[model samples]
Target: MRTTATSRPTSVHLFCGAGGDSDGFRRAGFDVVLGANHWQKAVDTHAVNFPEAEHLCVDLDHYDMRKLPKARVLVGSPICTEGSPADGIKRPKAAPTPGQLSLLDEGPIADAAWERTRATAYDILRATEVHDFDAVVCENVPRFATAWPLFHWWLQGMAILGYRHQVVSVSAAHIGGENNPHAPQWRDRIFIVFTRQSMRQPDLAVRPPAWCPTCEQDIQAVQSWRNGRTIGKYRQQYDYRCPNGATCGHRIVEPYVRPAASAIDWTDTGIRIGDRPHHGRGPLAASTLRKIRLGLEKHRVPALVAVNHSDPGDGRAVPAHASPLATRTVRIGDGIALPAPFITEHRGGGSTTRAIADPLGAITAGGNHHGLVIPYRKGGPTTTAYPLHTIATRESAGLVLGSDALPEDIALEDCYFRMLSPREHLRGQRFTDDYTVLGNGGEQTMQAGNAVPSNVAQWIASALLEVL
Candidate 1:
């Protein structure tokens, strides 16, 4: 029953899981005409969220692109797990540390899967030829660009198709809390926007301004940073050592620092300054802070260097600051450490004298068996303690332990670990409370994790609008 916005540019979303990206496009004033995906549950959820759009629950490889409606913009998020660092082919050459290694070799299977996945991107490009779309936006993990022949082939194909492209890496958390409070989860992703040769190449370097808590201002935060000499800038052996080796605090290396690509220095000084939260803001609630830390580690983002904490009840102790365990140190003389009195631990380990406190000081997904322990604080709501934010997977849901339960909340004790209800997953993904997530817990979880953050999608789409 929805009427088409004839005046607006139309967009076709392929691999449109849960329609978060499409939601952004709609917010950006694009008429989202079609959303196609392989998963019926995802398509069902998309239909529920975007009931007006034409929903095709067919696999992209089989879908007929020529039959699709003509549109000016095309956006796709190809499967990332196959091309991600999480994939086996991209596994680090170094052996994993104890308790770190994943036993399965996802590479060969993933590579085979990627062969099919990469086809979706190429298929979109081919459709571009027939449809003559004005622009295309593709997203995936930054590691996607590192996939062997696939990356090279993709660029070649783009060149042949007459599109100019640029890739920008961004994080949902650093996108700024004030404007995007809905998507505080820390997720790093890359966006590649390409314009047809006939169209004016847009300056796709545009990024959302980030709020600096310390400065109390919105700043054009640098999106990426590079430090140290550029690779392949080979100099003679004698030229490698620093001229001021004795006085210079930095290590002696080849004498070239790439022009600071960003206003924010990648140097340790910049990291320290950039990482500080806003002034006068109360420390993130202890339970919330613990989840953030665990999430950051999971995402491989740098851990927060300092936290406002209290001593643990058990004898286990930890360093007051995020130093000592530091492999590389940046001496930023900003001595502002705010106080949030909550239990603390160094590296989630207990002190030698005392066993690690119950509901360990550092929060993690823990293991499959126990799930995460909701920590006890003096006055906060006890019901929702730990694993505070629901992740995309059922395995990522919060679990409770009987020992960690209080006398009053004995009812929840038997429930022990519990998966986040569908509504919670939707909220974590920044979806509105009314948004419907189809299917059982497992399928819904996959859809949630795979969907792009609507805020990020809107941010990118809005920026693309200026260029388009």
Candidate 2:
């Protein structure tokens, strides 16, 4: 370890895509000294936002850690595709026992690739051996515990090196409240902190009181579990109980959820759905059209809705402004619904839409596919009420009205559609507008999707600071 001194606590981040971890550490009062990553684009993005810090575009698996400078904290987020469910690779049900071959059934080449990815975790251990860090933090998908066969031994190695570690499973959506900035996207991650001294794990879980629309009252929120197992996805697992109990017959109560509507730019109304070209064809895929119809069917009012086109559950539509968005992945699979009547102009003459009803789904490093569907009148503005009809084509649709009419009353021909921009994706990730994201559109999306939400990182850093 180098003997150079610093005024504030210093940290070094590995696999530091887009510098999300570094940004959080900075917010928590740490001087992020260095950020290293394997991808040149990611490193470039990090360098743009954190010009003060030294950046290295090198693979940690092969780099010598002894050449690195010493710091108070060492943070890393290893590549998680191998362990992530989105990749569709079958993960080991449990860590393999000694002398057992993990992923052998997948084939030698596949097993080798898996081993290469899994070995990234060992790089953290290698770094620990070379540096005398006050604390070491590693973030990854929760499945990392069972996916990497050497996970147990990795912890043992840390203990042998005189560090006590604690692993906590947390969601970004649950890390903020009245006193803290909220992460709009619901991302579930595991944070492992290893320190020389034992410390109490930071309580990052926050369940702010939720409003039960049905009960029309504030209620305490509790975790939802069935048969002793947690239910629901992301932060939705925490729900509110109506004071009226079973009599009220309202089971869909949700905790206070920050919506993704705050991140959208309504000025861009997007193109008409019928005009979009798909696969060189004149219109969108039939499946996509079906999703829009389904979304309109579910939400009949002039409210923003999120339609998860890629969801295994039949492209479900949820109110966008009511709950936090789902986790962002490398690919954008979620779409939005905007009613033309709701997309009115503000007093300043700037176009604005009603608040979104649900949070944006996970952003991925690949590209964004989050499309926007806007409902508008077919010929022009008309006061005459029309009967509800299924969305068929762009020429036949109209804006969805209130409960008096019904969502199906709107025609499909009146709807407009377009994919969300990269800047919007960054906003959902909780990155400030001023934070520069350098790269092509795809690169920017990748950086945003791969980033650890700065708020979550800040919370973890603050907790670590207390014990440091």
Clashes of each: 5, 32
Q: What is the lDDT of residue 206 in candidate 1?
A: 30
Residue-level lDDT of model 1, residues 116-157, one tens digit each, is 332346666667777777788887766566443476677678
Where in model 1 is the C-alpha error above 4 Å? 1-6, 83-119, 176-182, 206-218, 227-372, 377-419
Best by TM-score: 2
* Model 1 vs. true fold: TM: 0.57
On a 0 to 100 scale, what is the lDDT of residue 198 in model 1? 71
Winner by lDDT: 2
User: What is the alpha-carbon lDDT for the whole of candidate 1?
Assistant: 0.45
Superposed model 2: Cα runs more than 4 Å off: 1-6, 82-119, 198-201, 204-253, 277-282, 301-355, 378-408
lDDT of 2 by residue, 405-468 (tens): 2234577656765556778778777788899987666557667877888877888888777766
For candidate 2, which ten residues in a row score worst on lDDT?
385-394
Instruction: Note the Cα lDDT for every prediction shown.
Output: 0.45, 0.59
Worst 10 residues of 1 by lDDT: 255-264
